[model samples]
Target: MKKLYHNYIDTFRGLSLEVWWLSLITLINRAGTMVIPFLSIYLSDSLNFTLPDVGWIMTFFGLGSVLGTWMGGKLTDKIGYYKVMLVSLLGTGILFVLLQFAKTFEAFCAGIFLVMLVADAFRPAMFVALSAYSKPENKTRSVTLIRLAINLGFSAGPAIGGVIITGIGYQGLFWVDGITCVLAAFLLLKVLHPKKAKILDVVKVENPVSAYKDKAFWIFFIAMFIFGFTFLQYFSTMPLYYKEVRLLTVLEVGLLMGFNGFFIFLFEMPLINWLENMKNSKTKLIAFGLFLVAISFIVLNFTSWVGILIIGMLLMTIGEMIAFPFSNAFAVERAKKGNQGEYMALYAIAFSLSHIFSHNVGMQMVDKYGYEFTWNFITILALLGVFTLFILLKVLKKEKNT
Candidate 1:
């Protein structure tokens, strides 16, 4: 028992101070992530937008993310992750302030687009920074450390957001979020200097276009996209369902949203470390996570009991705990030399593009066909994920043997 405890402790050992600081930056940034989770509710209730209109507005946000991620990745190789990360953080912080003014539909869509465009860069750039700052053997844990920070912050954000909505309103939510972003950027600027330290001294830039040519990565990307569509329902679909069907209040929805992050914070790093220690069957682990995600949705369809929402959220959190960090770690392993940023960016596109499709499909179905059909469709997507990922594993195996 003592040996096992020591082994678990070792999982967190030896990551550089830079990695810890990066995670701290992420925690501060995510702690103020008050807008996105409540976006669907805000649109429907505040703006009085129709379900379809709400879907498209969020879809516009996704489109901006797609572009932002692509640009961040492409530039990180040329400019370095440090600059990209700083600019993204500072730029997005200002945009959050500007977003509060975008009350008109066209203005709101444009605001969301610009916000994601500037903000999403932080992700791929951060992935590259994680690779640069941490030892190769401890890569997974380094990423998990950042994930832990983000989840911890996410757990706090909605709960605080719920309180703020009552006292300060939505404007306060956006302003507070902006302040956190600028604060994180300032911390990064004041503290980090990896170039002088040579953490990134051995890097070499690969052909930026090379990621698209990798058959195995393309296969993984497709499976990731499908998995992401269902995995991201909490942001796009579930909030609306809880509001319209479950009749939950904003505070109740905030608690439910916070539940996912709290559960992830409680379970993910330890669980991921344990899973890695057991074996390296990453694809199997990911597929299993996808299966669990599908089952969470199925639970919703089968029961109207509010208790089921908690169960569903817990199950989905477990699945994410299993899958998300490993997914990022595996993508880092697959990068060619110094193109880590680009590869990580492509990996991010899986979640980004899902925003475009998942919201539109989910909301339209809910409006036209009802909520059950939306859940059923998500189940089909999840099953497809299992099948697609297995094929990706085979491709990966073949690539390795050659």
Candidate 2:
């Protein structure tokens, strides 16, 4: 146990101070990530929206993310990630407060679209910053630590959000969420060193278009889209399933979501760091994650018991632990020196694209077919993704991304 303790702490070694601050910012911002988790519920109960209506709203929000990440990525490479992150964080905070005032359905739709557009721009910028900040060999640990901070924040956000939800309702969630976003921005603006050198100081080719032409990147894009599409269902359909199908209350539902963060926090970093030390292949680990995620949804068809929910959450968390950080690291590894932001942007954009189309598809399927059938559909999609990714990796290895 003592040796295990030292090994776990060892993962924290060699990360730069800038990456540490970036992780802190991720924690602070994500800790206030109350809005997205409960957005579908807010639309359904508070605004009296049908499931399909909520789906459309979310799809639009995803579209906004697509714009945010693309533009943010371009700007990050042109100017620098620091400026992009500062503007994004500050602007998004203000938008969260504005969201509370948008009461009518049209107002809500317009507000959500704008807010996510501004909010999600931070993603590509942050990814660029993370890659720029970390030492070469420490990329996996740096990225994993950032995710660990995110889940740590997630653990606190929903529980606190639950209390605020009970006491002051969803509007309270918006206010709290807004305040935290601004706080994160303020920390960045005031404390973060402006003149800090980027990982690659000289800017290289700005054209990410060549990346699109690469057969390898397209394969990566498809695999990422599938991973993102399936992973995102936890926010979309799963919450609704727990409430409407399982008949759980708001706090109970919050606890269920919190379980995902809790388990990821407890297990992800230590486990992944250990795996990295064991010289695990990134693609193989990713395939394993995809299989577990597929089984997590399919497991629900077998039983509606709350235990099954916990079991599913645990499985998906483990999958997330293995898959997500490695995915980011893999992209960074493949990126030619000067165009990391563009690569990261494409990855973020593909993920947001999943939010736009595939998630809405899931929502429609859930509304039409109900939980068991919808989950089974997602399972089939995930399993197909696993097979496709296996073949995809064989091609990528030949392309020498190995």
Model 2 residue-pair collision total = 0
Best candidate per lDDT, number?
1
What is the TM-score of candidate 2? Answer: 0.88
Error of 1 at 98 (Å): 2.5
Q: Write the per-residue lDDT of candidate 1 for residues 318-391, one digit (tens) a residue.
A: 88887788778878878744377789899999889987787677767888888888888888889898899899
Which stretch of 10 consecutive residues in model 1 shows the poorest summed lDDT? Answer: 200-209
Off by over 4 Å in 2: 41-53, 165-170, 196-209, 240-254, 302-309
As a TM-score, model 1 comes out at 0.88
Which residue pairs collide, candidate 1? none
lDDT of 2 by residue, 176-207 (tens): 99999999998887657576544632335555
Q: Can you give the TM-score per candidate against the true fold?
A: 0.88, 0.88
Kindly report which residue stretches of model 1 are placed more than 4 angstroms away from their true locations once superposed.
Answer: 1-11, 40-53, 195-202, 205-209, 239-257, 301-309
Return model 2's CA RMSD, one decimal: 3.0
